[model samples]
Each structure stands twice: as structure tokens, then as C-alpha cells.
Target: MKPASTMRPVRTAEAATTSLFHRLFPVNRDIAIKSIFGVWGAYFVFVTSRFLYVAQGNVDALFVQRILMTSICITSTWLLYRLLIAVRGRGMKSAIFMLTLPTVVLANYIAILDQIVFDHEAVVFDFSYLLKAVDFASFDWAYVLDEAFTRYFIFAGWGALYLALSHSQDAQRMMAHSRQLERVNRESELRALRYQLNPHFVFNALNSVSSLIIDRQNQQAEKMVDDLADYMRAVLTGGAQDMITVEQEIAQQVRYLEIERMRFPERLRYSVDIDQATKDWSIPSLIIQPLIENAIKFGVSGSDQPINITISAQSEGDRMRISVANDGRVIEPTARADDRSTGTGTGLTNVQDRLRTLYGQNASLLLANSKDGMATATIILPDPSQIFQDI
Candidate 1:
């Protein structure tokens, strides 16, 4: 993910503006009013405490005076802040040009109005009377300057924080969209790969049948065609869904092997040891087919001794583990291995990719050579609860 520092400043400024307006309505408006009132109330109480000490107990009048001053301050600050934000993007020079004079004018107006409104003795907005009422000698221009700097710091700090927050929210939404697109792309590729397997396997099986027909083995050719038809039917059934029960997947594998069995009649054989519990589990459709095809291509198709392939599935704790082992030795570690008679390297590659897409890193396909003179491919994955519990 890109950092916020890399984000466009113009967009950030626009988002901040939007956030400010959104903070001013309905429930948000209520909150802002409450917050401003609370600040005034606290300042009013503080002023009343001072008046009680100064006048030796006449606190009500001084409390009212503080409320008027506090209200004037809050309203003036809010309005000034809005005006400044409105001109923020035109650069510091433009912002200062648009805001400084208006803000000074507003402050003077508020100062004079508070005197006339709160002090009924004052008949008009008089600068000298307002200055005297506020205690001119104790005005403290240095303190006023300090307060002005503090107000700017506080406002600008909040503005920066709100801008950062808005950027973070937008970044989260973007990341989620990107992740969704990646998932859809992966699923499309997997579906396309799954569909491609049926045809590739078909072409190979038909080619084998052609060879047998040329050799005048009409009976074996007929058996191959029947197996092909059954396999195609299974493909159609499984292709209709993204996933299928383990039992259905096994049925498809059996039909596929039957076709190959005809091609290498006495050279290939297989066994199954599926757990009753696993029969109800669901796996990605056509996932195991390509793995089985890979095993046959490398381990059974052209081995000197008649090859025996065994497929077994069982529940291991909360997960299902399936292993397919064939009686074909792995080439020596130091030797360069020859390509298998059947070209299915790409199929097995697709199998790995599909497994990763479906199960992330949790699902795995492992290949190893056992000391018992067999090459094995194992798939380990979580059992689908929907398939089991629903049934």
C-alpha cells in the first residue's frame, strides 16, 4: 500500500473540506453545539469564581458577563475558521490575504458588540468605553498575541489530523477494492484453466484410441470411447459448480483413469481407500483430476514393471489429507530426469496455482519420493463444513 505522504495534496484538501461540512449536520451539529456550550459553561464558572473572590461574593453579574464574552469568542472563532478553510488551497499568501483583514475586523466587531449588548449602561458600540470596560491597562497585547498563535496552532493541528484520518479511510476502501479485483482475476483464471483440462485430456485419450484402432484392437478402442463419454459427463457435472463433494471428485478420477487404463491395459492399476467421513467433504471442482493425471503421466504410463497407483483419503483432526502413490522410482538426485511420455507439466502447474487460489497458504500439494520405491503426491486442506453439516 502507498503511504499517505504519497497521496495527492489536492485530493486530501478536498476530503478535509468534505469532512468539515459533514461534521456540521444533524447529530454532528448537536455535538458541536454541545461542545461549544460546554466550553463556555466552564469559562463562565471560572469567571464567577474570580468574581466571588474579587467582590467578596457578588458572582451572578460577573458570571453573565463571562458568558457573553465566551459566546462572542466561540462564534467569532468558528466563523473565521470557516472563512480561512474556504481559501486554504490558494496558497499561504492568498489564504492570509483573504482571511487576515476579515478576521481582525470580526474580532473588533465582537469586542465592541459584547460591551454594548452585555453592559446595558453602554448605549452604542464605543471603542473607548469597550476598552475601559475590559480594563484597558490590563489588556496585555503580548497575551493577546500568544492567544492568537495558540488558536492558529490548535486549528491547524486539527485540520492536519482530520486530513490524515480522511486519507486513511480512503486508503482502506481502495485496498479492499484492489483485493477484490485480484480475487476475481484469480477465479477467472482458475475456471478457464479447469475448463481447458477437459479438452487437453480428451485430445490425448482420443489419440491413444486412434493408435489402438490402427492396431486392429477394436474392442479396446470401444472401451476407451465409453470411458471417454463417462469422463466427459463427469466433467460437465463438475463444471457446473465451483466445488464438488469428495465422492463426486473421486468418481471423475475413476472415469479418467479407466480411459487411460485401456491405453496401458496390463501396465497400469490403482486402488482407493477413502474414509467414510471424507465422502461428504467438498473440494474445488476438478482439483484432484489434474494431480491424478500428472501421476499417471510420470509414474504409471511407461514404467517397466506394471505400475500400481493408490489413492487414499482420510480425516486428520479437522482437516482432510489425500495421498496418491505410484510404484515408480524418482530419478537419482544427481541425474538429469527425462520428460514423461505424457505432456502434463503445465497441468500440474495449474493444479498448484488453483490450490493456492482456493485455500491461500493453508491448502498445499506436496510431492516426494518414498524409500519404498514410489513417487507420491499429497494434498492437505481444511474440510468444508458447509458440505458436511448441510448433508
Candidate 2:
């Protein structure tokens, strides 16, 4: 006896094979009946035409008899094909054997019917003549061989056509399934990148509120709490989408800046220079907020004089270029070992990862020192309308 564990895999494989067979050659009654009728109809027309040609356009009793006999042979051949499909289930070896075996038997049966029913000269039908007609000693073995080979090739051709159609349908179904899986994976990765931005922004905003409370600025702390509340609500609501219009994103950023301006009213100055044409363009939600937050933390916080932070966007052919710049101090190209700003490096890294996830290598975020003693963060993204059209 085989072990149960070993038996299970064999049974599973058999079941899967059976399922594939049914998918390839479905045996629905309506479809089978329609196919059989259509095939036999075509066969009837061809046989009738051949008989008319041989008889020289004569419509006589012998012609009618030959037509009826050929009809019976065609119906029998179709029935045999259906039976093979039912009993053998499309296994290549079994189907070939069963389909071919019937051809020889059916051809011999049709030959006997033709000889007895159509070639007889008797005015009255007689069983004695029919019996002698089918006798093995009198039968033409050569004729039977010719008929069998003809029918065998015809059925083989039919099987080849059926298999070709079945394979084509299977290929189409597999391709559709593969595309669906790719789409699902892309959506999942985009959601993960979108979620990463919220917590990082929240942590820094909350820290600023704590600082205000510690410095005994109660009025400013209360107002910052309100602004933070509004900002959190906007972020949470927009988090459900992978991208939003540039106008909406800038509004959220302005709310965030409102909270920061309260913390450094005297030393922080900011401006936005977005083109009117680019206002309705779409961008990854909260994509630029972290860059602005980084500017306030490192640029304004490290400076004694009033520092102006600027956010601007413009279209350059196929790409949208956005920059956030501050005049507080030049940012070092790399982080130092002991550097501890409000956002060490998490904010910038989060933005870079989100850009890569959304646009592969087409979008980018870069940080560099400007010619006028300011730190600038620039981002380039594909056009918003084109992105929407692609989706």
C-alpha cells in the first residue's frame, strides 16, 4: 500500500489535469448539438453535390437513397466523436485511438449501407439481398481500406483544428491573469509609499508644539495645536489617494507653514511662485511638504537673520520642475556623524523613496546649494495630465 502523503500529490495532479481538460474542451450540451448539426449540414451539402455530379443532374430514387445513407454515416461519426470526448476526456493518446478506431468501423458500415440500399436493382426491398450484400466473402476489402483511410484523415484534421483553438483561448486567459497581478502589485507599492509620509511629518510638527509649550509660549502653542489638527486631518483624508492636484498639495503645505511661522514669526519669511497654468496639474500628495519642513528645520533654525524660504513650480516641455529654497544657510552635501537637526535625514529619504515608487526613474528629488547662499531642493515629475491618461 502507498503512503497517504504520497497518494495525495498524485490525486491532486490528476484533478488538476481533469480541470484543464474540461476548460480546453468544454462539453456543454447546447454547444455540442449546434456544432454537430452545423458539421453534418456541411457534409450533407458536399455529398449531395458529389452525387449530383456523378448522376449527371438526374434526381432519382437511387440518388435520394444514397443521400439518406450518407446522412446516417455522418451522424454516426459525430456521435462517436462525442462519445470519445465523454469517456476519454481529451487525453491525447486516448483521443487519437478512440477517434481513429471509429473511422474504420464507420467507413465499413457506410460501405455496406451504400451497396445494399442504393446499388440494388430490386423494385421491392428484401432482407435476403441485404444479408448477401454484407457477406464477408463477397465484400471488397480494397474498397473498405480506401474508405477507412479517407475518413481517418478527415477526423484527424478536425482534431488538429480543435486543439489549436483551445490552446489559443488558454493563452489569452493566462495573459489577462498576468496583467491583473502586475496591476495589483503596483497599487500595493504605491499605497505603502504614500503612508510613509504622514508619520514623519507628524513627528516633527508635534515636536515643535512641545518646544513652544516648554518655552512658556501658551498662546502660540494653542494656535499651533489648532494648525496641527487641521494639517493632520488633511493628510489623513488625502492619504487614500496616490496623487492629488498641485493646488491641493500647496494648500496643505501652506497649512503646515502656518504652524511653523508661529514658531519663528520674526525670523521666518516664505513665498510661493507657482505658474497659473500648472495649478491644476497633479502630483504625489504631500510630496513637497517634507522638503519645506526640512528647510524650516535646518535653514531658518540655524540662521540669526531673517531667512526667506521659497516654493515654486513651472513646466519645461514634458516635465514639471519644482523647487523649495531657503536663504538661511548652505546645506552640507552629506550628513555629518554628529549632526542632529529636527529632521536628521528621514524626511528627505521618505520623499526620494516615494518619488521612485511612483515614477520609477522618471521622477527625481535633488538637494544642492544655490549660487546666492541658499539651500535648494528640486523635483522633476512627468506631466500630471499624461500620468492620468496613462492610468
Candidate 3:
């Protein structure tokens, strides 16, 4: 009589109960097999020991019946275990209701089955008799409560064990997921730091080539192109790496300086002073290139006087201190706004950001004018051997 969209199949009480039972006790082949092995193994041992001691070597129908009843009890407990796991997180009240009701019903059902099928006694299934005692005018509830009480411990034990195992598995899964997310985030940050170096270096190098082309220095331009090709090959090869040794980094910077040398000729003179003890120390790749580019941009490009830039490194106890200094004329704070020579000026900031990302507070970059009037950029790195070990 209803529209097709509104039409719903009516579920009877018995059908609904069966659906709820199946939903709460969903079939898990592994858990089912484990329950059968574990529950039956323990039940059989207990029943066999009791029968052997009480029956005194006599095999009887009662002993067989007891074994069968124990098997039924174990089966019920395992089914209850499945229900408890399903009802977990559904609140304590729901869990206790499901547990207590099923146990009581199953115990009563077994008692009825024992009287009818195994004992063959005329046992009346009446609630009135449960309230009456052998003595007149006295009501005793013990007989009615005996079977349910006896089975409750077995079900409770199984429930406790199941809850413990479930909680353990959930904690392990949460820990694994947390670790996976941490690894993903660390990798994403490393990729971001790597990408920042490439474009900034390429932009400066290309700008130099463009300047040479404008000046019509064909011979020097051709040589610069060859040098640039070699420099790019090295950059591309090492771009994917997160860290490089001090020596490798210096070699890369030397390639960059060689290109710059072709442009400046006699106007630019630079030197690298590195301690032999710190050469194998690991540092972030291309970290120092931008500082050198900064030196070139502000030092040689802004001055008519020949500017000298120096990069020096030394070990200070557990730290490696590196400095890039240039003898360029310093613009006073008042002249900074009028100085057209201060380019986009992102190189120093880029170096600082990458240092912060890679080393947090363990590394630092500082910019200051030295005593001899040189614009000095200093970087202090943590102990490279210890840093590598930490990574």
C-alpha cells in the first residue's frame, strides 16, 4: 500500500533478535578456531579430572552427560566473548545488559535441556516453585539462582581476557599510525627545504648569464655557459640529497664562484678558508650558497673599489663556526632606504629559514659588521658527527 521509496520490510521480533545476535556475534574464523581449541582444551581437562576422581574408574552415562553440558557451556561462553567485543564502546550499561541477560537465559535454557533430554526427570519450568522452599511458608531463591551464578564466573573471565587483548591491539594500531604520520611530515619538510635552494640559485646564475649577454662579451659568455652547465649538473645531482659533507658543499660553492669569477674578473677576489678537521662534517646541502650570493650582490656589485670576499670555517669545541665576510662599503641605516643596490634581499632570509627548519635551535645564522668594517655573516653549526648520529 505504501510508495516504493517509503516501503520497508517489517522485521518480526524473532527475526530482529536473530539479526541482533548475528551482528553482535559476527563470524571471525580465526577467533572461532582459537576459542574452540582453547576453551575445549581447558574444559575437557577439568571435566576428565573430576570424572576420574569422583567416578572411581567407573564409566557412566552421568559422566558423559556432564561432559556434554560442559561443552555446551564453553560454546556459550565463546559466543558471549564475541558479543562483548562487539558491544565494547557501547557504554557499560549496554555491555552489562548484553552480558548478564544472555548468560542468565543460556543457563536457564541448559537447565531445561538437562531435565528434558539428559536426566529424564519431571522438572516443572515454573517461576512459583523457584519462590517456594522444601520447608513450608519459606521462600528460597538459591535453586533458581544456582545455575546462572555458576556460569557467570566463566563468562566474566572470558570477557575480561577479551577486553584486555582488544585494548592492547587498539593501542598498538594507534602508535603505528602516529609514527607513520610523523615520518610523512618530516619528509614533507625536507622536500620543502630542498626545493627552496634550487630556484633561488638558478635565478642568480641565469641573471649573471643575462648580464654577460647584454654586455656583448661573447668569448667570456661562451666560457660562462660551459661553467654554468657543469655547475647545473652538480646541483641537479645533489639536489635530491638533504645533507652533504663540508667538502662537497665547498666544491659546489667553488663551482658557483668560478662562474662569478668569469663575470667580475679583477674586480672580485674571494677566498675559502676551511679547517681540515671540519671538512668531513655534514651540513645541509647548498646552505652556504645563498650567503655567498648575498656577499656578491651587496659587496662587488655595489662598489667601484675592488671588493674581497672570504669564507672561513673553524671548529669551536663541539661547534663549527663559518663566516662569509666582504670588504664592501657599508651603507648607514639612514642610507639603506636610498640604496638602490639592495636587490630583492631574500637570500639572507632564505638561509635563515632553511637553517631553522633543519636544525631548530641547534644552528644559528648571524649578520653583523665586523671590527674591520666588513659585512660578516656568521653561522654556527652543531657537532656534525653528533648530528649525523641523531639523525
Model 3 residue 117 distance off true place after TM-score fit, in angstroms: 12
Instruction: Give Cα-based local distance difference scores for all models.
Output: 0.67, 0.70, 0.69
RMSD of each: 11.0, 10.1, 10.1
- Clashes per prediction? 0, 0, 0
lDDT of 3 by residue, 1-391 (tens): 7775554444465688888767655654345446545755686678667755574433454555556667777677767766776676887776777667786777666555444333232233322433333342232345435645655665666555555556666688799897678657655775665555546456766787888899997787788888888877776665777788888888988888888877688788989999998898888887888788878877887678788889888998889988888995444435555655564545666777667666667788877888888988889999754431223
Question: Which residue pairs in model 1 clash with each other?
Answer: none
What digit string (tens of lDDT, one per residue) describes model 1 on residues 42-109? 65566567744575332444455556667676776566545655664566665555445665566555
Comparing candidate 2 with candidate 3, which one achieves the higher lDDT?
A: 2
Give the TM-score of each candidate.
Answer: 0.60, 0.65, 0.62
lDDT of 1: 0.67
User: By the lDDT metric, which is better: model 1 or model 3?
Assistant: 3
